[model samples]
Target: MPMKVRGAPQAVVAILAFAGIVVALMQTMMIPLIPQLPRLLHATPSDATWAITATLLTGAVATPVVGRLGDMYGKRRMLLIGLALLVLGSFIGALSGTLAPMVVGRSLQGLAMGVIPLGISVMRDVLPADRLGSATALMSASLGVGGALGLPAAALVAERADWHLLFWTAAGFGVLAMALVLAVVPESQVRGGGRFDVVGAAGLSAGLSCLLLAVSKGVDWGGQVTAGLLGTSAILLGLWGWWELRTGEPLVDLRTSARRQVLLTNLASAVFGFGMFAMTMVLPQLLQLPRSTGYGLGTTMLGVGLTLAPSGLVMMAMSPVSARISRARGPKVTLMAGALVVAAGYGLGVLMMSALWQLVFVSSVIGAGIGLAYGAMPALIMSAVPIGETAAANSLNTLMRAIGTSISSAVAGVILANLTNAAGLPTLDGFRLVMAIGGGASLVAIAIAAFLPAHRVPAGTLPGREPSARRAVRISARPRPAERAGLPGEDE
Candidate 1:
């Protein structure tokens, strides 16, 4: 029999949300070390960048694979394994003085990126019906919070202490998160029991590695190398799609993904992801550029991070608001509202970059949009897919967003590199151009969101919600007065 573990719903939600934030925090924790990596590790500037590139590549490959494993084996088991990897990676990083070990450690850290999606999936299986929406909203927005908060925290650590302390602190946090999961979060009884698709897994990994590596390194690698990698990626991905369709149990269910609601949401996610990265990439550089540049703010790294930190808080604060909107108007409308706001934020950013306060205001507006949009995506996806497929579906959606960010990074890099001033710094015009493109990307997402179903059962109501609640009623042999009055039933 599947083990059905139970616990206090609120504690479970908090533990999972904390785990999600910790995992997301790993993504940007190393940014402050990038310039110093060459001198510290005795490597060329290009080679030192692998420390960041390794994480991005590994994260792209691991997210979907781990999600499938969680669905087949157990989500809590997979989540624990991810946290264990995070701890091990941090320990390795803490000891590393060379680029090689640092890259290896960062790769392992990336593998744990699956934890956020798995945490959201667990909420669906465990939380009470009414608690599920807000819980998942908070979980989804945790990524933005971790990333925004990590910048200042990491900058402070890099400035004051031995850089290795960053890894040690990360290790300590991972250990704490793991212990909380073991103590509080329950193993989900739901499972998509099937033979592991080894061939599908390998095909997808190889394809994504080639695709993402090409996109990420294209600006640095020049045209022929980028073209060759793109060709290889396209061929491998095409074959993988063919293989998945023929397999008994595929790694990703392409047919389910092709559904109008799911298809549009994923499409919007990619564009929204593209829109999201523009601010993260643009704001810090603009804030830290030399004061000699006509528009540069000349702030220190710590100041840049602090200035942007409120955006993360704004995201967190918007989570419940997103849930409430999803509950009232449907996730489709919530998503549209979010994309529209993000577009407006970028439009404002283009006109407001002369002052730090303007940048903060723009970042916070963009953050709120991202929070609403991110909170709505899982709801749209879960509502359209089978209950057992939750983790895998959410993971794929996460992967799509990662792909969008990778593309955004490449596009922004090319623009900045080519649009430099006499001092070799990015010109104000280049920053404005990137902001315009970001707004355009959000506009595209809004257009896609418009095509989604006008109303699917209210967002965040899982496919299994009513059935599971009814089962709870039967097992308890006493329905709550709210259940007896059919409030949960009204969601359907």
Candidate 2:
């Protein structure tokens, strides 16, 4: 059972969500600085990218590791550690005038990426069942919310002030959020106490690092290096999977992850992540390209940021709507509906991009779909897994989404690079192709979601209650029959 907390539930949700937004803001804070990093940090363009790549690689590795650690230790405790890393990273970044230290600070910021999934897990372990749906929905939406809002905020800062001030602002927000978490958020009493899986952690890290590095940098690194990295990743991951099955206490329990609902939800998450990121990649470039190109909107970075900001607000606004849909028809239906909406959004982008308003409309539709899909994902995962494995399970799902986005970034880069015009800039056709591909990927997610087992209300629950609502209550209540015999050594 979830531990009852003395603090108001609303305060807990707000603090955790704020922490999520701050970390997400850090991810995008450097976006406006990307083009300037070469000059500012005294590095070549190629070398400067490591500052961004460092964060991506570390975040991919950290989500699962810190999630497992959060489960073994306390989620709130681990969350504080993540926030501290963010603050420390921001401070270092503020002080750095060189590429090496900047990359180090960015890597530390990436380590805090586990905060979102950890926050969802914390909510699962403390909030009242009545509040879980909308609360988790909002928490999941925070990733998009922060990214959307961060771009405009970062853009304005980058345009008007010394870039160092951006990091200072991030540090200030981190400190405030950290203090609020300490004051308002309650530590989950639930614990999966066991010795840390050192070898498992190392193997998983090596595998993910290899895979993400190859995918993200393959365009710059050439075919041979990319192929070599990919092959190594495959071998490392294969061995890691084998070890996980045989080990007494694994970092991720393959058996639980293999459950039909968990399996399908993860597959859908990857496809959805890929589809969602394709929009981000295509939109800004289209917006910022010169209007002489006929297809370009001829806008500044700040304009691009302002245009996309509404989509973020729409995503947050859709949380309650997503929760209601999940409660009415089950998360399965919500996921399918969300995927279809995303596909429609991309379809609109491909068909109508001559005006800024059209792009905003396209993005807002996609963002709404993302909010719904993201919100439903945790409900699907948490419903399937044991309470003890909430953090690890959610972390794994988060990792899958990251992998999807990385793959999307690589594929979109290839498309945009190869299909350029006379000026060596990506043409309108390439942009449309990318949007069409995003639509196709969303369609694929719909197919995968179709395979998820229908949500079933627990036996002995009141029949009068909505099945999804009853299911949420059961998820927060005592273990169901399926979860009673969960992974070996799980606490009851």
Candidate 3:
């Protein structure tokens, strides 16, 4: 099709959505290979765990930094850089046959986690005001989409082919996404004009690394180390906060983030992340547990993957519904609704986890909730902050979710490790306990979201929400930084 005739906006949404999915795939791609890591990499089990930890730490650090970079420079440019990192990491991981290089590669792959936020930021820049909500919703939901879709496929590849193919396949998708982005996506003109905050970045990275390290590794490392790490993290983060408030170009705007809308949303996002990850962590183990254990389903990895795949598809399907809900009831309402749905899902999981069909039903219900809340988050954040800060703000929200999940996993691990049946198998009660915690987290999310200030970005201000001429003045009163900077407005 000729360039003029092409539906460029639609194409941009599709490409960016696909890119988000591709990056998310990296998160769960290692799930199937985790057990085999010690043997495959000729490393100790403890050491092999770094393959997972490396990604978590780097992702936590990279998210805010990448967001700041995207704000200062261009979202599209940072997005491509993130994709290139994934490609490079995937290639290195594909070629690695041992532990050290594998950790290095996986850490590199983690940097790409920022792609989803950057993509959402770009949509704000380049997409029409009318298409923004749904487009951004779909992009946000891609985190769940790739994660859900990746597990079964990765299980299949891990079982049927060489393990190296997993990373190779990831690399292949990365390359394709990069090509599509470069070909069709234009550089966003909107920029947060400022110098990069190196001090802020380094400080945030250090604090987060210590904080997450404590949370994620506490189960393995025991009490004293965990407590010390936690204490150290608290100190460093306290200092980091002090510096951020005083700095000119901070990695995260603490004051803006402290606003009622942004603060509550981040808190809710964290709880939602924890709640959503509960089903994911528990279901697989329950499905793959030995049938002799009575409560265990005694299935293979592929069986577990297949049983859980519907949740991801459900998430993708529900994104538009979520967007519609946000449009009608407002994003805060959508978020609260999603939290309730997730709580209901976890409640059901607590009640009916013995059967495969039951697990599938429960997961899908939670997926629907995730789709709704995830879709609303960017809308809430974008409306609260200036156009220039969207990427950084979204990145911080994404980091909050990551922190939630990391903490959730650690908490679940501790519970499961200590509470077991006579056969040493994790008992049904323990699983229910996790579900209860998940449900509780969702309730907390609802409480936080309920307190968010009542406001909506008008149509035309938001990509999809087009206010009428009468209302446009009120919406457009605060011109985007691009307009003030005297650059020709490209989209928003």
Candidate 4:
């Protein structure tokens, strides 16, 4: 008789899903407060934007480090640590009355961004093989859902209650998530076998911080500072790459990252991230403008939020469809479809800005595109790299997306600044220009996807069905041992 098998705990999955939601919620919970920050904190627009910048910078630095630690120590423990940091940060922000302390708290809370990937790693340990793919897709979608759900909720709280209450609620959620994780999640045996490269981590942190700081601050700081920061960042990044190449156990395997599948997927992820944010940043402003402004639709905050909310719903609904499409046509094809859909959505936005429902339709279409793209990326990266490097590689891809968002923010600011109307309000013309640029960028991503090699296994095959074929592909597609030996073990 065949042996009976034990299934993963449903409670554990629930806790992990909740954890993903809370982490994602924190990412965009403050977005509604963006315009209000100047008045509430008595700061300039550029200074207030630091709240966003601080979180992005800290999250970017922490992601790869946390991923490496998850490999070396344990994902469950790392997840708990990240959640704890989030709770503490939220509490600190709630108590703060000034911008500086608030910025500090926001930066600390950014550590939580690493929790979802860590939780996904744990899910691999607990979830049955048959259910892993769907579970992974759901967890990935949770990130977008949490962000979308948090916005209106946060806006309502900020409007009716105190702004500080938002952070308090976040703190409460963090505590509950941590407790549930502790009670339900089991530890895994996936452990790293080498020393962690502190130097590489430091280099990466410095380089990314410098790069993001420049990008985030460039709108106010002008061309000289932006050029200088960008130049310094380039040099630091080059050095960081060399340091990783020579390190005993670097945080990221540069060689694996250099592989065609891994490299192109991450690059495409950056553009995907950029495209996603472009619509998000511009659309709300377009909807909330005064009707007299000629280009404004005069929608209320609540109305605007509701309209945008459906886009998120569309994204959630499309996750399964994206996975199915990926299975049938390969992830590369799904990715191209996603990029093209987003580009089409942007084109639609340019043509239909006057009508509120038209905006809603375009948003939903774009959200569906992002959902399809986001769901396929992790699977592609995981398939290409070794199991041990899974968290780090995935984290690096996530960081690329973050980098792309940061750059998009800068680019959008520049475009808006250059194209304001006579009343000092940003016009529909600027918004259209931004959307068109985003669409063009998505086209670039489609081209990249089109050129990607077709080496993926047919969907739904048994894992061990073609080891030799996988190895042969890996040999040709992966980097040489001489190139990767200093970084970490080759991807499985």
**Local error of candidate 2 at residue 417 (angstroms):** 0.5
Q: Local distance difference test, per candidate?
A: 0.86, 0.87, 0.86, 0.77
RMSD of each: 5.2, 4.0, 4.5, 4.4
How well is each residue in 1-492 modelled by candidate 2, as lDDT tens digits?
Answer: 345665798888888899999998977888888889999999999999999999999999999999888887889999999999989999999999999999999999999999999999998878777778888889988998999999999999999999999999999999999999988888887767666778889999999999998998888899999999999999999999999888767888888888777899999999999999998899999999999999999998899999999999999999888888887777888899999999999999999899999999999999999999988998888877766678989999999998999899999999999999999999999999999999999999999999887663233221112223322222223233455454322212
Q: Is candidate 1 or candidate 4 better by lDDT?
A: 1
Model 1 lDDT-worst window of ten: 470-479
Encode model 3's per-residue lDDT on 155-244: one tens digit a residue.
999999999999999999999999999998877766777778788888889889989989988867888999999998889899989998
- Among all windows of 10 consecutive residues in model 4, the one with the lowest summed lDDT is 467-476
- TM-score of each prediction: 0.94, 0.94, 0.93, 0.91
In Å, residue 459's CA in model 4 sits off its true spot by 5.6
Residue-wise C-alpha lDDT for candidate 1, range 98-125, written one tens digit per residue = 9999999999999999999999988877
Arrange candidates by lDDT, highest first: which order? 2, 1, 3, 4
Alpha-carbon lDDT of model 4: 0.77
Error of 3 at 492 (Å): 25
Clashes of each: 0, 0, 10, 2
In candidate 4, which residue pairs clash?
A: 386-491, 386-492
Q: How far off is residue 316 in model 2, in Å?
A: 0.3
